[model samples]
Target: MIDIPSMQRAGANAVKAIIDDVISEKLDVEKKFSSSKTAFRIADLGCSVGPNTFIAMQNIIDAVQQKYQSQGFASHMPEFQVFFNDHTSNDFNTLFASLPPERPYFATGVPGSFHGRLFPDFSLDFVHSSFALQWLSKVPEELLSKNSAAWNKGRVHYASAPDEVAQAYTVQFAKDITTFLEGRAKELVVGGLMVLNMPGIPNGNPHSSSVTGLSFDILGHCLVDMAKEGLISEVQVDSFNVPIYVASPKEMT
Candidate 1:
């Protein structure tokens, strides 16, 4: 559920900040945008089914509404449209049901990695993603087929890991980043700003045995227990690490 007070403040402020940044300098995405009707096209990439998402969407709308109104652009009342997207597996039904009947915003499930063409060429004015995109996809089979010291080289239960497993995870994360940027470059119209806010390891660290601290170690232990129970295999447990990205922000940049 949407936290009433928190969202009313943070969500609202986040929307205002983005709009202000773009509209003020005519910077980022709003720079090249010239529209007669003022129909602004905005999108929230990786919008999941939740109150936070809804609240954020509303906040963005409110900010944009206030923006054009103040500019004497009120007469045209820039036609407004919002697109809420997530991976295809997202619970769109839940999102839509939570939405009001009037539907001030339009919502859709794009069902693909948000890093790519969620919209047509030069279509978006602003794009926002909160708390999504970190996971790499399922580990590849070839890497884990052998439960050996080579593939499953680091079989420690909790505290340690081998270098190769780390490499496999890192490689996938880089691929995800590249894919994401490639898609965004094509979809976002020049001047469109795509704000991606997600958790990352401090600085530009590749998530490593150095990072993840103890939490991931606990996760590894759980996996080992599961493997012993036959809930999974040594091969499965061999592939550790969150599928999500934990790389440094500079790397993402």
Candidate 2:
């Protein structure tokens, strides 16, 4: 049960630029809609429990409304239907309960991974995901195999692991990203817009220099310390690893 607000602040800050870019971009909403009666469908991928998701959706809606007003369609504002997506095991109940009574859009919960198809073909006009793609569908299988070249033992992520271990995570991330994009491509309309914001390391910078990587290392050390004190078994610490992979900008491209 991590503090959702505090955990999401960094990601929220990182994506502000991208969100602004989307808002400023020429969306041609009126032309995209053509008919005045079409409902604008927006999907927030990986929208975990919270107020952060609400804020993000609100920003997007407000920006779109501004665009509509500028285009002389203020009188015929289309209805908005927003889909909040996340893994099936996510605390959707808490998310629903926390919804503001004054919410302007019709919100629906879509439970599933974003790595695969979650919507009908050409049904979505906009898609947003923040700090969510960093999570792989699952940890690389080779990392868990003792005999594998990428075996990541006594460590959690590829931060300080061998090159092969890092490569394995990179390969998995690429695969997952490909799947995510391909799925979204099928779901979004021809002129649809998608905005994604995820943590990325600078080019040529060692993972250790990144805050996230350093934090993982510190957590690993803490776990080892706990094991040494017999509060937790060393074997347990050795077997556990986080499923997140922080990619570089080049890797993303």
Most accurate candidate by TM-score? 2
Which tens-of-lDDT digit does each residue in 5-37 have in candidate 2?
666766676676667667667577667667556
Off by over 4 Å in 1: 1-24, 27-34, 101-103, 138-160, 204-213, 229-232, 239-241
Score every model by TM-score: 0.75, 0.92
- Candidate 1 lDDT, tens digit per residue, 1-253? 2233453346445555765565545532223335433456777777777666666666666666566666655555555577888888898888878876665666655566665566777777677777666656555333554664436522422224565656665667787778877777777766666666555566744344434434566667777888889888877667553454456666676
Model 1 worst lDDT window (10 residues): 150-159
Clashing pairs in model 2, backbone N/Cα/C closer than 3 A: none
After superposition, which runs of candidate 2 have C-alpha atoms over 4 Å from their true positions? 1-4
